[model samples]
Target: MGASIPPPPPVITRSSDMDPHTLEQLRAVKEMLTAQEEEAQGLRDLNRDLRERLEDCETKIKKLNEQNDEYAEKEKVLSHRVAEKVRNNKQMSVVMEEYERTIS
Candidate 1:
């Protein structure tokens, strides 16, 4: 004849065996988890705001760079004009000196 398998042990319940300290610790853990969830949500909102601000700053910087290029082009044109004026003035001074010497 084959041997039979043993049965599993039965569970025992006792309402009087509950520990008060363990219950209090469980409640404290739940409160901590709730607080952590709220803090995480706040951080997410702040990160989104910062990302939007960074995009705005990037757009402003691009516009300023375009304006700076326009100003640089204008400056180059003015510089060329000033150089021509200086050349003309030097030539006129030499001509005046020659005239004075001839007249003396």
Candidate 2:
């Protein structure tokens, strides 16, 4: 087999050697990247704020649900008491009617 050839030397290029158009393109690319980074940072901040608001809303909803449950239980108890009073009133009316009949 033939001997392997040595690799070519590395081409070192200085910034001064780079053409003006190429340098302008690089600067434009850098500016675009900076703008994109700023936009991304703003989005991240907005996302954090939205997350905080969502957490607050969820907490409020949980508290409201608990309060609703307590109110429902109180309403049920009150309804039962009202029903008991109605039954007692009906019984008293029946006894009063019997007494009136006996007097008549």
Candidate 3:
């Protein structure tokens, strides 16, 4: 195999050697990165707030659901009582009708 070529000497360049356009591009990139970081932070804050609100909403929903369940149970009990009263009333009416017939 042929001998490997010797590595070239390191070239030392000053920061001033960078073109103005390249420097400007670097500055723009930095600014963009900073803006993105700020935006990300704001989004994180908003997300936290939304999460808190969501939790509050969920808690309220749970409480309401529990209340609804209690109301439903009460309604069932009331309906049963109402049905019993209707049956009693029907029975009383039948007795009254028979009594009226006998009297007439």
Please write out the lDDT profile of model 1 over residues 1-104, one tens digit for every residue. 88998898653365345478866876799899999999999999999999999999999999999999999999999999999999999999999999999999
Candidate structures ordered by TM-score, highest first: 2, 3, 1
- When sorted by lDDT, best at the front, the candidate numbers are 2, 3, 1
Q: After the best TM-score superposition of candidate 1, give how far the Cα of residue 75 lies from its true spot, in angstroms.
A: 1.2
Worst 10 residues of 1 by lDDT: 9-18
Q: Which residue ranges in model 2 land beyond 4 Å of their true spot?
A: 1-15
lDDT of 3 by residue, 1-104 (tens): 99999999766476577788877997899999999999999999999999999999999999999999999999999999999999999999999999999999
**The best candidate in terms of TM-score:** 2
- Give the runs in model 1 whose Cα sits over 4 Å from its true position: 1-22
> Among these predicted structures, which one has the highest lDDT?
2
lDDT per residue for candidate 2 within 1-84, as digits (tens), equals 999999997664876877899889989999999999999999999999999999999999999999999999999999999999
Question: How accurate locally, in lDDT, is each candidate?
Answer: 0.90, 0.96, 0.95
Scored by lDDT, model 3 comes in at: 0.95
